[model samples]
Target: MYKLKTKETDNSVIEFIESVDSPKKREDAYQLLDIFTETTGYKAKMWGPSIIGFGAYHYKYDSGHEGDAPLVGFSPRKAKISLYFATGDTERENLLKDFGKHTTGKACVYINKVADIHTDVLQALINQSIRFLKETYPNH
Candidate 1:
């Protein structure tokens, strides 16, 4: 059986943020903590070793793989902050137009810092991700 790596843990989100070596990154993590929590209306959670996640959902694929993951999350990484959201939402792509300096991959948005992006647009992205996940997988 295939296993998912990004499972939620009981680790402290604050502790993880504090572990960041760069003080500026730590500060940005705190700012993102506040923004993501307020946007998702859910408390922060530690996903795997590095991701600070909010709400969660359970997803299963046709190939029989399944796992639980955060509805939205971010990780303050050494290179850049990574924002996790639903992968296929056109609304998310449209909102990224005004999101400020950022790059994105499938399901992950990368920014240098919280200040590099507009918080309003970030909030909108998260909202769209949450709604998309809930509508797509209501069982979890």
Candidate 2:
């Protein structure tokens, strides 16, 4: 069985943010917490040790893999902050064109800090991600 390392836990999101070693990352963590909460209209929860996630949806793949994941989330990492958004959404890509000072992977966007990007664009990405996931996993 493949274990999902990032499964949701009963950890405290505030405690995690306060424990961040870097002062700047800690500040960014707080900033992200507010942004994600207001944007998604959900309280933040700890997903794994580091990720602060809001809202959730269950998904089942064609290969029979199934799990629940946050609709949007982020982790303030040592090198860069990882922003988790919906994969395979054209609107997400389009918004990133003007997102400012960020890099993207399969489903995560990396940013150095909160001030490096536009919050309005980030809010749009958050909204789009939630919409896409809800539509894709309607039962969830």
Candidate 3:
């Protein structure tokens, strides 16, 4: 049985943000905290050691792997700020066309800083991810 490594914890989201090595990244993290919280209407929570997540849903795959994950999240890493969103949403791709100065990998959009991207598009991505997840995992 495979266990999930990124389980939600009681750790302090603020403390984790403060521990980020770069001051600029730390500030961006704070701005993101506010943006995500306000957009999702859910308080941020620490997911795993590094991810700051808002809201959550349980997902079960066809392979019988099931677990809970945040509806949307972000991590201010050393290289870039990773924005997490739903993996299979076509709307996400459409919105990202106007997102500005960002790169995407499967489920994350990486940006150098908050100013590099449009916050309105960010909020749309967040909302879309939540809506998609809820519809996909209606029972969870």
Query: In candidate 3, how many Å is residue 3 off?
Result: 1.1
What's the TM-score of every candidate structure?
A: 0.97, 0.98, 0.98
Clashing residue pairs in candidate 1 are: none
lDDT per residue, candidate 3, 1-140, as tens digits?
99999989999999999999999999999999999999999999999999999999999989999999999999999999999999897999999999999998877899999998999999999999999999999986
Clashes in each model (backbone N, CA, C under 3 Å)?
A: 0, 0, 0
lDDT tens digits, residue span 25-118, model 1: 9999999999999888999999999999999999988988889999999999999999899987789889999999999877699999887889
lDDT value, residue 67 of candidate 2: 92
Model 2 TM-score on a 0 to 1 scale: 0.98
TM-score of 1: 0.97
Ranking by TM-score: 3, 2, 1
| Model 3 misplaced regions, further than 4 Å | none
Q: How many angstroms is residue 51 displaced in model 3 relative to the true structure, after the best TM-score fit?
A: 0.3
**Winner by lDDT between candidate 3 and candidate 1:** 3
The superposed Cα distance between candidate 2 and the true structure at residue 22, in angstroms, equals: 0.9
Note the Cα lDDT for every prediction shown: 0.93, 0.93, 0.95
